[model samples]
Target chain A: MMKNSLMRNVPENYNPYVSSDDYKSKKRVLIDKKATNSTVEYLESYSDLFDKLNITDGMTLSFHHHLRNGDFVFNAVCQEIKNRGLKNMKLAPSSIFPNNQCLVELIESGAVTDIYTDYANGPVAECISKGKLKGEFLMHTHGGRPMVIESGAIKIDVAILGVPTVDKKGNGTGKIGKSACGSLGYAESDVTYAKKVVFVTDNLVDTLDDYQLDGKYCDYVLKVDAIGDPNGIVSGTTKITKDPVGLKIARMTAKLLDEFGVIKDGVSMQTGAGGTSLAVAHYVKNIMQERGIKGSFASGGITGYFTDMLEEGLFEELYDVQCFDLKAVQSTLKNTTHHVMSGSRYANCFDDNVVDKLDFVILGATEIDTSFNVNVTTDSHGKIMGGSGGHSDTAHGANITVITTNLIKSHMPIIKESVTTVTTPGADVDVLVTERGIAINPLRTDLIEKVKDSKLPIVTIEKLLETAHEITGVPQKIERSKEAVGYVVYRDGTVIDTIYKID
Target chain B: MKRGTAGTLESNDAMIMVKESDGLKITITSIVYDFFHEQIENVIRETLKEEGLTNVEVICNDKGALDYTIKARLLTAISRMEEEK
Candidate 1:
């Protein structure tokens, strides 16, 4: 009774209705007739929904990463599968955070053989780098993720949506609960396409309308006492290092902003949520305040810091794909100037996107070589570590991409003779900042000449590398296994680089 | 620099009247913003329960304390209160 053709001819502006052309189109696809009725099913617990759904091998399961490191749902569900002795189920998460270390155990148990995610960090990335998972790993941008789901390229059998707040009707919202994480945009596509959608929440309300996510799409609602740690949701918003060394780097970056003449009013900028990047924002804020300048917009993973800047009239608008703090959530909910953008709109290189309009973007790097090739993933040991996220897209799109970091970390020089893996090409990076000095990429001679007389210390890329080498000596090259554990795909879905297992 | 100089400084009620740290003043002034907002009471109750304390005062000169900062401030306030006799 389920129409297979309904998914094929979905209109440009399709609304969820049974009789509309869109509904008829969806009804034509009768793969499973029993699932057509959108009725509410009260599940006693998550385990009950898992049992009722009959999750089997080769079935695709999905999860969202709104909770970041504080999320316990993914690991909890995967643990249940491991306990049930399930195998070969593809794990398609919106993103994976560091706290989901239990996924390493699930991978070893053979319950999850394949993974498709926008980001992966910590032990899971390490495990994947070691070629631990049996199947291929695919990385998609936030925008591409929804596109893939909508196109039916990656069919999701069951989507386990972790709700910070949910009603009996399975409607959920992340903006108004104890674990409120803001917009449910990432899970919207999954709920629409998945054969069965399950709502897992720690906080359940008396009515469905209280939930922010549309309840019409959900099939079952299961409640738990505590869903995720509120602290972890905004864990990335810590203060950047105020060390004199970091301040010097930040000053150099700010000077670079001045020299590029991109420090004028109405310029748009984006920066990572790292300590050093946040430091750059702090410095930029001071310059803006001093110069009496206001920016046009700020974008990317928005934090309360950025929202406050917007609220304080520092920026005219904020384009947020995902909010990093509760202040951001409150701002997005209350302020009209704060806009929510899809991942594709945020950083999909295949599409004409907003990142292309950014005047400057301050990024963090684990290592950079003289070639200007950057590596945000892996370490000197070639161990699988970080994630690509929006690094490459933003680097390529931003008018001036400045990579700010200390010359050395933990006695290891960050400017290495050669980077372990190239996440962003050197051609895209405009400047590199060290505590000692700033290095302009050779391609930006105009920038080089413009800053010639600036008081900020300017040095050659080679000199910065030498400074790092002087302190740490030469680093030992890591021996890598021939087997590819995971691949870092550019925003266009091309294999930019691959990570191998460290022996 | 007597302990009792900054108010009646109890064991856990210590206060240091030092100069403000150098940085942006990310101030957050939250006073149950929407009184009739759904689950407003529940959020406050849950926040207190999650923080694991009874009574405390939080004075924050926010350089932009995000949601996490607000929660952290409350948590710090509660923990400071719990440490007292």
Candidate 2:
């Protein structure tokens, strides 16, 4: 069995993270952008669309994840492909949530030989960890996804998008219809890069006052009976955490931000769609309100909580790439200040992006090493569970990136000597906030000096690790494999870590 | 005691079910079983030995519970078994 408890660094094949200043540019995928064609086929069948696209074996088919876990189009399209006995097809969805469990079967049947995505969870993730996948799994960050595709490293044969509403000319809006998801940010890159773009919608209107998807980019439109449920956006946990441990960490992180003077007026921040992160946002919002701080904007997959801040005039605008809740979708419908942006505009570090403008950002972790390298990609057992959606992007861009999590999660220490996989390099990371104690990175001397004489429980990361070890005891080494199932690609288009298969 | 149960299936806790058995038998299922299974088994065996109880069956649904928690829960179940007798 492959032992996994040893102190391992970046593998030989991969480039170790040196400094964010040492970053290099990636390949730029070329798109032949043109005006709207005279003829746009509006069809009602997936089979016809596939046939029209002339899909063959090993073709790279892509999809947008705006529908999230409630999405019906991704599974439906993949199922049709499987039913046609297609093999070696490349599945490149922006991200895979739990509801897309059809992928588990697709992998098992050898129908999907390769996979590329920003994030993945549930059965598909578990399946990949077991090494059952027949080919390479390319894990990209939210921002890096735009980079990877635009650079031509990962090409799209066809882009199948599940939009909520589409007008007669193929103009689409994600903010209206029965299953409005609020933004088409992720699908924009696909529509531009893919050889053919298919817009699948259950609702078709004669005209849309504001459409996110331009008809010129779309080659075909599929009108389905139902696209997906809007409610699935909140299928996973994204509520403000009520757990005392979570609340404590959030409060401490907010206090740290205040002490560091990051909570001043015109501050720009981002947080993960997790309860702990949202709790941190909640605390930050309170701080903004108390100080009458009118921040510039909040960005990413926005939730109702963020909209509430915008509605109350706390922030000037909301940069929504995707909506996380129904309230957020409603906010987009009514609030003009709540704007829609493409994925590249949201976080493509090569050009002007939202994440780069962040003053401070709050993130969560499955494991964080003493060096501050994080692993939101795998569990302690070296199993695939999640990938970096925007973890590294925000961390790399934000001046202060705070990681908030419980010290002990389900009897496992959140702090480790070395993480199983490095999703975000330690060089970009700023601090770690746990319920037990807060650890400031040695590299961040400026932050350390800000709270040197504070009442907060500031301890070395090693001390926090010792406290956790004392409680959970030393766990046995987990089994792993020499054969890597996938690679965690950094925002800079460099391979940072390899996820070994479970032996 | 004829039968007893203690603790909960919550994280960092163990839900232990105990019933009358001719000899000591412990069956465990845990989320962290890969890493701490042997240590968990040893703790349960030692806890039983210290209690001077031989006739018992412990089924521990462990969600990464510590050694002391296992001992305390087992002890409570043992006390409940005696209360029934």
Candidate 3:
């Protein structure tokens, strides 16, 4: 009886339902056969493809924004959805441009209930600022986007990719067509994970061999008359300001660079694409040209002006997260020196990233308070106007952060007793430059002493504040609400500051 | 130095000439290039086609005029012609 019980208690080595070694080998062989037979489908139009895909409510949709102000596809697609009375759709766009102003209408119509993107500019940011979306707007760095997709945090349902050129097999390229905008780096993550990937192109090729995006992953292809304007593709050349007042500030910033002793060989720096910041770049370029110095690298939103410096041998390399203009895109495509950086590699502070190596960074500000807190969001009227696009990240990472702005814009003083909202911490900002003078943060006394002998205009932070107040009688204190409208996230995704609704 | 009186046009095309101020004499010529080259010429011709044979020659000093700006200037000049009569 004991022997009979032991035989009954013996466990089976494997179940029939579970795949054994032989079953696994057979499954792999089947997958290989299917892969070889896989073929791409071509649809007559965008609408036809959408109908076939059956894009339903609560579906996750994505868009690429290589065309900044010139983009029309995002708005067009959203408008179509709005007409169809779709609701609760999640927009997981790589980025949103100012030209996609129609997104505001979609938000009003409740078609887009949630948004996840690396950056938002123009009216979409305005709507988000007004707390219009049903769900929270989750912001991610470029690298963070791919990471989230890989982790299945953001599973894409339908990715509507805007291609400059595409093949019949659904292969796509953005560098050669009439509206060529360059590398499809941002769309790489979506194509990998999306359940259905659609390529919308103006120029359709006969074959898939020349396309940069692999047709093996793409499922459907659609053709249109025009994708976007080539001129609008590179709307701004990322030029430096040549204005007198701007030049003075640029020169002062260069002097500060000299004083801080970060102007030597193998140093790295970053600057914004704004006119004044670009002016600082030009001045820095002049300094490098004169001293026979070379920088290790430059990083951030790469522009033509910065690309020119990289090509001119001022810097050994350019780590570009996103190309802002045609020149930048061309250089990134042709030149080996220009390296493409993923968003996570660019500024995700949670991860050990490349921004930590930055020696200096020049930024622009809308208002600066006496305590050195900088505000890039909200105007004097407390209206939500701007975004914290990589502002807090650069300020926190760089050893020296210089802010440039005129003392007054349109007869209104920019220096206030307290900023409307603090986008960058007071501790991070080292210097503030105005057309009239320069203000060194008191916390950075060492920088002040270093530049004491320089001919560049230097003044105390208090003095600059006083001067601004003297011109335009001190601004009345703004009353803020306790209810938060939006949150300013630091590079590490921490809540740096919260915005209240405009009263 | 060549001297000429510059005039402002009223809504009814009445000319109000003013004396020139002293400064560096500079003339700025503006050329409006459309995204499509033909659109610009078509716009200029369509707006000015209706006006009668004109004696007043307008030296367009363009700094960088948008499509609307070009149309407005041409219309204003045509309206000024009515005042001359």
Which candidate has the highest lDDT of all?
A: 2
Per-residue lDDT over B16-84 for candidate 1, one digit per residue giving the tens place of the 0 to 100 score: 111123321222222222211122223334565665433322333322222333344445544444454
Worst 10 residues of 1 chain A by lDDT: A1-10
Order the candidates by TM-score, highest first.
2, 1, 3
Better of 2 and 3 by DockQ: 2
- TM-score (chain A only) for the predictions, listed in order: 0.85, 0.94, 0.81
Query: How displaced is residue A287 in candidate 2, in Å?
Result: 2.1
Q: Which stretches of candidate 3 lie over 4 Å from their true place?
A: A1-41, A117-121, A127-132, A138-155, A166-173, A183-196, A204-219, A350-352, A442-449, A452-455, A480-483, B1-85
Candidate 1 residue lDDT tens string, A1-503? 12122111112222211211121133212122124335667778667877899887788999988888888788888888877888898989988878988889878878889898877788787888777888867665565576566656678999998888887666777777788787665776677778888888888777854444577788887777777888887553446676887777787788679777988899899988776787788888988999899999999988888988998899999988777777887887788898876665676544457788999999989999887878886776556666567787788788899999888764457897667776677878889988877888999898888888888878888999888666544554544576666665544444556667775
Residue A390 C-alpha lDDT in model 1: 78
User: Lowest summed lDDT over 10 consecutive residues: which window, candidate 3 chain A?
Assistant: A1-10
Clash count per candidate: 22, 6, 4
C-alpha RMSD of candidate 1? 17.6
Q: Model 1 in CAPRI terms: which quality?
A: incorrect
Q: Which ten residues in a row are the worst by lDDT in model 2 chain A?
A: A1-10
TM-score of 3: 0.72
lDDT of 2 by residue, A346-371 (tens): 88877578888899888889999999
Global CA lDDT computed for model 3 = 0.67
* Best model per DockQ: 2
Global local distance difference test of model 1: 0.70
